[model samples]
Target: MPTAELPSATPPSTAVPAVDLRGVAVRYGPAKAPVTALEGVTLTVAEGEFVVLVGPSGCGKTTLLRVVAGFEHPTDGTAEVLGAVPSPGRGTGLVFQQPRLFPWRTVGGNLAFALARQGLARTERPARIMELLTLVGLPGFERRRTWELSGGQQQRVAIARALAGTPRLLLLDEPFAALDAITRERLQEELRTLADVTGTTVVFVTHSAEEAVLLGSRVLVMAAEPGRVAAELPIGLERGPHTEVAALRATPEFARLRGELNLALTSAAAGTGEEGQLPPAS
Candidate 1:
């Protein structure tokens, strides 16, 4: 079977964006002394596009993801996912830094729980569970306890669980941040493949420039203090089954892109009241 193609950088003119935010802003605390998490943030994510938000800590990366997930309402502007206003547990799948799996349930059972919540029939759940497990490279792990798996394996299960609901969009908040270098790289490849195969639009938040460059079709760099978009860079690297990741990373173009992003991020951090702080690698 032919591998699925990545979505084009240019979406069709009439296509409705998977996510649209217009002059969005979020504030916390009382009206007397409020904290601004985001300000004048306007963004649109095309269908099947994998967009990464990268910035230093407290840049409102997580806040932006929460707004899109409908967990938090923006104090200022509009936030929309799949055309209408987004709501929790609707058309969106979320993966956090931790696996957040049910230790009481087996790997398969955890996925089955999500599928069941989606209203799948009991008789059809097993096959779908197996398919999801396989998709995350955890086939036949249905009976295995969540605690028995390695950290990376547990995270794979988490990703599978997120996919169980068949979400149109996936919101990941540094899901691979805690893993070791090798494990993180492997998961990154798997996630890229999974997104291509499912054509799931993804909005991932991370502090790692390498992660952003590798996973995102477009990288949006945000700045601190009332976080806002500072730069947008489209990855023009070739992506296909034949492309070797190591070779791609070794290329001068990859280094150039990474440097460009690092500079943009550094520049955004400058004069933002949090100067001299470097971006996190994980």
Candidate 2:
């Protein structure tokens, strides 16, 4: 679950990078016996970019996400979000593989809790709750108990809660990984649309190449064993308000990108270092 830290005193700035990390590294355990999770990872995410990280297990995808969210600090290098050091509640929203909703709260109540944590006053919460629910395609679900909702619906509520803070950056860690195929696809479409509509910077972590291609404006493939970026691909999908996921996925370009990502992922896992360039989308 995302920590409910108070928003920073300074308002988020659009003038600077949404996320900037320079030669970042993370390690655990004692000084001499530290287990490295990430090494020499430098990444910059501009405002409104949907960046996805995909790699095999033990890669630093989740560690990178944690660093950006201010949940975990990098052992080396500097990380800044919106021109300031990242800290919990500092203009970030987080969602994970599990919905992690408060079972005790009703749908609206959960959102209300988040809104309040983000400094929203009580009087403003009701309207904001309804708006968030509507945005997530769950209009009028304010009264629904979290336990009463299906897995997909529960995740939707979780997303709504995450957005309640109107976060400038949204961090999602395989939020759709646990769902059934159909539900996962639906949520993927919804999430992509939501990101566009909200214009929020996002860093999503997943193991699926298809999901990376489908959602990210930029896809990063990381190599494990002291994880580092092995490949970077820009998803140059031409999209508009009316673009549909089904139509987009059926295109030859989508297939090519997916194939490229898969090959890169394989190479990275094997430490082959063969596929690193971003070829022309044409």
Candidate 3:
């Protein structure tokens, strides 16, 4: 038995889900020519838990994230957040792979934009923005323009903006997929701290198995094209530096787990990795 120490599941005390998906499916265009982005999917994210979904391109990972973020409606089945259907700006925050900040806005202004939606008082926006920047280790970066910052820094600002609303649910769609190794690790550490501090529920999508293993309390591996959950890996690693990339990569167990997931992902991609046989890619 692997001895990794992950966050515990909800104890017997409470049972309400922060987010729930039951037999959800999506299709575009006419029913006969429907493209299944997700099919018969079901999952639950408990309050303050972090769940990561890993899959290759065209696996409907983004579509799933959007469903939770309230950006996309499911064609069938139920998807709810906090016991209600989520809508745009409904206590959910989103961070994408790109910063997507307004070119005209400064870093502070971008975050202020999120706060403004909640009708925060004018006098409080700056303070809130500053606090967020500091949280992402971008202190004193309030005056920096979007184009002026490096790619990694821009992502930090994007995350800060998403967090501006003090959202109960935060959805990250490959937000750090583009960053280099060092930057990725730094941001990952900061995110762990942020999650611990705020008790925010997070559902993030990624292509890397190692990332999912390191940051997530539970990992859901989705199959490509008409994405569906193929395998779920619970992360039992202790928090802090051990959660760091080097520490994780240094372990033989890590390598073995990564190999398992790689095989799982490879199978997921070809839609035939089940039954102990690898399928040819489509």
Candidate 4:
């Protein structure tokens, strides 16, 4: 297999934040009565930071993720990734709630297609495919059909395929929401490890406060009816491979942060407006 360098629209730069959004808004429908999915969203994700967006349904969590992914443009303000306006084919990878893999192709075949698009040569693809499968904990399962794997395994493949492009920023919209509790927990740990190993900046969207607390270095709580950031809480708990999952969650700090975030969500839903713009956690 030939090794191909991942294509990047913008060169790497530590000076630029992984993501920058200022007073961003997204609206749809007619000029007379447009649906506002998001409004007054201001966020900045530093390089290698794991940030989670949590909010109620229709709060525009997914909409904000799409804005960063370049699938949707904001109606106001600026959105930038890696120092430039977000664009498709930029150094970013996306994983959705469902594992959107091709059933017709084998796991390896699916990965091969992505690698080919990255300009990796046919001869170089096999090795790269194995490497990716291994990274996603699917080692030597390349030849298996997508339909043969369990849902968790299939999602792993989807994640591996996303990483095949070697994205500098990884955007996930509730990727593990559909999984069972046990499977979701396992994937969360794996994702944390993967992030540490790859140093890829992550912007994850989830409705679960526990998931947000477990996976995010910092959690951004959003409110509905024109989504906006309501609170930002930093998880000071230990993370990555070194941390014990059950023990960490059981700690006092973990519980405290989780409680705070839940309160923020509750306030947002109740429309108290009291939690309207807490300063970003330092």
Q: What lDDT score belongs to each candidate, Candidate 1 first?
A: 0.85, 0.86, 0.80, 0.85
Per-residue lDDT for 87 in model 3?
A: 90
Stronger candidate by TM-score (3 vs 4): 4
* Native-to-model Cα distance after best TM-score fit, residue 135 in candidate 3, in Å: 0.7
Model 1: how far residue 59 lies from native, Å: 0.3
Give me the runs in candidate 1 sitting further than 4 Å from their true place: 1-13, 272-282
Clashing pairs in 4: 1-123, 1-124, 2-123, 2-124
- Candidate 2 per-residue lDDT, tens place, 35-103, comes to 999988887888998989999999989999999999999899999988888898789999999999999
Compose the digit string of candidate 4's lDDT tens values, residues 1-282: 111111121223456788988889899999899999998887788899899999899888999999999999999989999888999758999999998999999999999989998899999999999999999899999899999999999999999988988999999999998999888888888899899999999999999999999888888888888787776776678764667567778888888778777877887777774454432222
Superposed Cα RMSD, model 2? 6.8
Give the Å shift of residue 201 in candidate 3: 1.0
Candidate 1: tens digits of C-alpha lDDT, residues 1-282? 111122222334569999988889899999999999998888789989999999999999999999999999989889889988989879999999999999999988898899999999999999999999999998889999999999999999999988888999999999999999999988988899899999999999999998898888888888888687766777777789546567679988788778877876887777442222323322
2 versus 4: better lDDT goes to: 2
* RMSD each, Å: 6.1, 6.8, 4.5, 7.7
List the candidate 4 regions with Cα displacement exceeding 4 Å: 1-14, 275-282
Instruction: Tell me the TM-score of each prediction against the true structure.
Output: 0.91, 0.92, 0.89, 0.92
Cα shift from native, residue 159, model 4 (Å): 0.3
lDDT of 1 at 275: 29
lDDT rank, highest first? 2, 1, 4, 3
